[model samples]
Target: MDVIVETRYGKVLGREEEGVRTFLGIPYARAPQGERRFLPPEPVEPWTGVLDARAYGPICPQVANPLNPVDGFAQSEDCLRLCVYAPAEGTGHPVMVWIHGGAYVFGSGQSPWYDGRAFARDGVVLVTLNYRLGPLGFLHLAHLGGEAYASSGNAGILDQIAALTFVRDTIEAFGGDPNRVTVAGESAGAWSVGTLLVTEAARGLFQQAILQSGIPFQYRTPESAEWFTAQLLDALGLSPSSWRRLFDVPAADLVSAAARIPARDGLNLRPVLDGVTLTQSFWDALRDGHAAHVPTLAGSNREELMLWVARESEWRALSDEERIARVDRMWGPLTDRARDYYVDGRTGDELLTWLVRFASMRTFTYPTIRAAEIQSEYAPVYLYRFDYRPSRLGAAHALEIPFVFGTYAHPSARALIGERPTHADVSDAMHAAWVAFVRSGSPQAPNLPEWPTYDPKRRSTLIFDEAPRVEDDPDSAERELWSDMTSLSM
Candidate 1:
């Protein structure tokens, strides 16, 4: 049976399936089209009558192939929506809000893998949301105004904040606790969670955070963002005076133009360190103990760079000399130790994968661990390492998603987890651990070794596998390799 509940913003209807109630495609904010394309999200007007929220919302604009896009998903500019799933029949359950990640370019709440039905069954209200993406969601102009116009780069992030606001105001009516909320995500979503952690406006909205392989090194400063914007405008032959003309261009054209800007060598349209919404870089905020009081669960997979690195052979093969050039170009002359660790006489696909792994760790995992360390000092922080390798593919990026969700037999299971029974069991165990963590900040599951909260002393972390175990800091070697490298400014 479908149940309709009235929220502070509007009436939302959800259907019950397998003991879980799901409300899909609920608009948290109005569509960001026309003049609102690059601005903060506006509130969705309250509706008087029952609203049918049966189907998932349209995904944000993105290249279909996350790895290499030959053809992309169906495009649209009016995609701003959120979905909610809850186990409660009435009220008072902990809320878990999830942000899907596709490098701020792809994926949506609608993705089958992100289905929150399982989480709902675990006695939590799970919310998934979609935000503006790519150029349409992250463009900054030289119109030169104040906070409203000065830093318009992180429109996607602002949309997320609007979604949180909507939840804070309305989730209670949908059987969720407004004060007891946890914001969790992976990849770009993880990055978004980290961004929200430091955002002044986002403070007090969430009480706990969970980050899975969030890139901690991608913050672009205001100057860098502006420089990227100028480069983009120049490429399109649009004069500085014509900046306002962006309001009229088709959203697809803008995305295509932004896609052409090339993201290699540390240049891309990531969340900028605009002094407005984002006050400073993630590392700075973390080191300064900005989010000291908020409990955190953060970790990364053992082979975070393997999959991404494995595919590097296809990126226009280069010579030995060219390999060094490319690596230097990408990371800009690594330290002698760092250089030897990655490119010490290595060549061909092997060299490329090493270089890719080095870059990936530097870009994503290193910061993730560092943030965990910083947050651990202040709050109860739990750290983990997904080390279970599925036959052919090593413990790769995004490998933990299905495992955490516990959907090993789902349609996309084979593609996501490979066709193996051992993998399925591991996924189930990992999923249970996550469910436990959601229930309580610690990941203490039955039949598992005692998982300890992260601290500078032991530097311990739970390793998820068929035989899950708690290991004492797995990547200390690699982490120390880049410990002295300067953090990217927010």
Candidate 2:
């Protein structure tokens, strides 16, 4: 039940459960406390003595999200920790490093939803880690703080690279193949994976990528990041000249102030275009073959935005004037043209459905397709659409987490997938495809149909539902809704 592994940083103790060996709370980078706050991650200092790796480490300081809470775990500024689940009896097993998503604000590697036991049982070494979030990890400060804060906005992203670097150097001791590491995440985590695909620092750290409901292009430009920073500083009652006070403010207070950072045109405080860490957009990088070496499997749930809008009564009860005004704000001069496509004569649930679809396409689906199309030109890319409606609520964002990770029985997952026996069956099929994709370059599984690589022409996409099938350009009509959108709504 007990095991010891000597890593370059130090020796650590771990435990075995069932047939999998788990090492918890392994620090990949040094604690970013005190002066290190808002800076890129530094290499973990080598430790003496056998460190006990028995519990999940502290997660980044964050406000709790009702849907994805990290309450059980302790939190701190020194939260760059990782958990490893590896097969007890294998060497050179495929490795999976999972980055969690909570809109770049909340969520942790320690979430029960990310339990890696299933991956371990299936002969994969699964690793999950915590990184800085919200203002602590992504507050754009270079514009205000000069060279010392040049990489401040991308600190979270650099934390991921640091974790990947740790895996490459250390996972071999835990029976994992460093060369076969696959980076995977959902939502904001997916955005990180997509961003990693193009990041120069992450060029060779990963071999494959799995992005669920995010494509690389969702970052704040320097102007937007600076605006958000100004908002944050203002919330703290400080001016541009008083930026130094940010370092002295408590993390909890920063989180509180960040909550007040008003969203503009749907922008949130997330990874920024820090000119240094990332030079080009995901689209440009893909077109230039930055991710050509990595095979990719990416997708979005059918109703990604519904997770945000579906539960709100205001979305359904909006007066026509209010809802139409919302559309006008987004469409501007093209408002009538947009209404013709999404409005025309629809109302009530029909109109709500169209609105949700339009939101999904503009934000998630269209960007996903664009990433795939551009990346497919240089490498093998597989696309998917998760269409399983766990209930009439529709397969909203992050609903596929239960199926993808075989965690349906988790209370939160159960809430999303329901108690249907078929949910497990679908999970089995989808999980197998994900495992297959990680093992080989293709996602061919026993239950899945022959899935062809995505090209602009065929655009073959594997649809995961009660009945898994392959479709060429599924929902092409809906996809065309954003055909002329030089700019996306999100």
TM-score of each: 0.92, 0.96
lDDT string for model 1 (30-127, tens) is 88877776778889988878889987666677665645342233456667888998885657788889988777776786666778888888788889
Clashes of each: 3, 0
lDDT per residue (tens digit) for residues 93-197 in model 2? 999999999888899988878899999999999999999998988888998789989999999999999999999999999999999999999988999998999
Worst 10 contiguous positions by lDDT, candidate 2:
327-336
Q: Using TM-score as the measure, which candidate wins?
A: 2
* Deviating ranges (above 4 Å) for candidate 1: 66-74, 88-90, 142-147, 264-267, 312-325, 331-333, 345-353, 484-490
Q: What is the lDDT of residue 53 in candidate 1?
A: 91
